[model samples]
Target: MRLGPGMDYAVAEFPVPEPAPGQVLVEMAYASVCGSDVHLVDPDFHRPEMVGSPGYPGHEGVGRVVASRADGIEPGAVVLTVPSGRFGGCFAEYQALDAGSVIPLREGDDLPHVLMAQQLGCTIAALAKYWREGMRSAAVIGLGSAGQFFVQLLRARGVEVFASDVDAARIAFGREAGARAVHADELAATVAQAHPEGVDLVIEAAGLDATRALAIELVRVRGVVGNFGYPEFQVGTFPTMAAFRKAATVEWFSNAQGEPGQWCFHEALDAIRTGAIEVGHMTEVRMGLEDVPRALAITAAHGEGAAKITIAIRPESAIFEGS
Candidate 1:
């Protein structure tokens, strides 16, 4: 599927991309829609930049390499292809990606759920920089998949986690992840009353600026606000009154910085593959490749009980569907 005008998505076939030197041609088995992909489709933040863009907005994918032009990497290898451009887009059935962009996966590993590592990597990369083993407490705003992952990861580190979301299902997921789940309406007051001094850190996973600002209000004096969510606006102002008053440190969790060695993604994949962390339960929704437009809409709309919406490109016989 390609991005059409006015935030529309329509299916169009493209030729199988040929691998250049140092590139690999992957026949995608599965791909997942991400929240950032939603920002790409929003008219307010879009401008047909990649017109006829082959997978212009998709990045999360797991597939098998059919051909390789790079040394050491071989054909028929199951890999996670994290493409950053049009040629390697995963929304299509095939992706021609740079050798460095593909990470090998164990053959028997469930490919679809492995897609979570792509998003997981983004979170852990930021956490690796700032997360301490025994912080006083942390608040994860926005109980989307990213927020839930933060709650799960933070709780494992022995920190108290307070989470919020408008969706009841996501709030429930946060509770299951061991967080003190609260509705959006009660988040600020709940955490404020509980901690009083504010949380040690705030993981603002919702892309809204309002949430970004709210992170400041919820964070402790001089606390960190790791901005993981993509802002939906092209150009917008942020409320800094809270941040200024709190002497807060706000940082955006950048995915590109995680690309140099791809160590973050590597670690995420290993954790998921080894059962060090569970991502299977997080991938709760599945749809066929043809439903990408609908899938994007569902993902863009935030949540209606959806967690990690997937586009299964291959036949049912190809993947071991989880229970």
Candidate 2:
């Protein structure tokens, strides 16, 4: 399915692409609908620049290279792909991608798990620069997939994580991830009473004005606020005076900087491989390629008890064993 000329999309058929020199044709096994993908499809959040865009809608995918004209990548090798403006995207049955954009997966990697690595990689990249040592506590707003991932990542680094979300299912997932889960309405006061000086870090993953504002207010003086969620439109006139008074460092994050070679992927893979970050929870929602329209709609509404919903482009047997 392709993104809209407006707030609409339709399934269109195309001939299977043949690999060009230095490119590989991949048969997609699993592709994930990320939070950003959800927002990008909504009219309230859609960008005019992307109206009538021709590329597919996804970036997180795991698949087998069915044909390769590239040297390093061989036929049947499992690989990863990301969203690229020049190369298009992966929300389809097949994609022919640049060899450089495809990262070979390890032996016995699960398709869905590898896809989880793609989203986790973005979080890892942000933390690489902003997360500091000696930060003992953090509050993650929006206990969705990203928030749950942040909880595990922070805990691995020995930071106490407090999380909040309006969704009960997500709140439960946060608790299972070992975060002290709370309702969004109670987040600020809960953290204030518990830490007094406030948390050392506040991660805004909800992508709402109220939650973003709460993140800023919940951070201690000189603490960091990592804005991981993207709102539908620009948020004009921020509460800068409050942030200023607290001397906060508010950093907006995006995973677009690094591609296949980023250390973030390696770190996330290691965490996954070691079972330090559990991805089983993320695989709760699954569908087939034919269900793309409904999946996109559900994800955009932030409903359907979603975490990381995966589309099975191929049978489960197609997933590599022992991942």
Candidate 3:
């Protein structure tokens, strides 16, 4: 699938990528749309260079290693291949990924739902570096998949998470995930009335200017703000002066910041496997690669009724064999 500006997506048969040295050629079985993908498809973040690139914006996926030029991982291994590049090849039949970007999983790893681990790993990676002691209260702006994960992680640490989003369904998901959830329109007032001093930490997961600013505003003096989502531009202006005035600590990082060892991804997979993170409610998938455009449109609309919009590229409940 080739993506273009203004949500234009076309299905074109492109040549399958070849494995480079230390890379694996994966036969993609499932891929999911991410909040970042919606941002990339917008006219504001369009890149002409990627106009005709196949699978240019998808990064979350699960597949089987069809062949490998790398050691340790071999053919037939089922894995999660989530390349951290600006463009990804998971939307295609096969994507050639660096050996390190693929996390090997069990042959019986749940389909479609297991795909949720890609985003979970991202939240796990970013959160591991920012979470700390004495953070009693938090505000997560955006109850998307990433924001929901952040709320769960924070609540697990005994932090009172006040989560907000424009969508009603997601607000319910946040509440179900142990957050004191609210509608976006009610966030500021609700937070103000509940915590006059503001929350201890605020996570900006919506990546919009207003939400980013709200994260800073909702944090207490000397509190921390973690920017975890992809903004409209590669370069976005922050309320530096406001943060400075409050003596706040701003931690802005990417999900790929510590992806090399795959330890975070391993942790995420283990969590899912052990039922530490239940993804049963997140598995709503489109049938095939041809549905990429609609999936993107639905996700971009923000009322898709699915926590995650995934596309199953191939058939069969069992898509892999133990390597």
Q: What digit string (tens of lDDT, one per residue) describes model 1 on residues 53-135?
A: 66656788887778899998887788887765223378888878888888888857777678888888877888876675457
lDDT of 2 by residue, 1-323 (tens): 34444346656677888889998988888888877776666555565665544335577888888889989888878887865422346778788888876778888776677678877888887776569778999999887778888888888788889999888888888888788998888888789889888899999898877777888889999999998857645544467899999999999877543544666776777778778889987886898877777777887666567776888888756545311
The global C-alpha lDDT for each of the candidates, from Candidate 1 onward, is: 0.78, 0.77, 0.81
Local lDDT at 313 for model 1: 85
Per-residue alpha-carbon lDDT of model 3 for 232-292, expressed as tens digits? Answer: 5766677889989999988987757256676777778888888877677777646579888
lDDT of 2 at 33: 80
Ranking by lDDT: 3, 1, 2
Q: Count the backbone clashes (under 3 Å) in each candidate.
A: 0, 0, 0
Residue-level lDDT for 208 in candidate 1: 84
Candidate 1's TM-score reads 0.92
Candidate RMSDs in order: 3.1, 3.1, 2.4
With a 3 Å backbone cut-off (N, CA, C), the pairs that clash in candidate 3 are: none
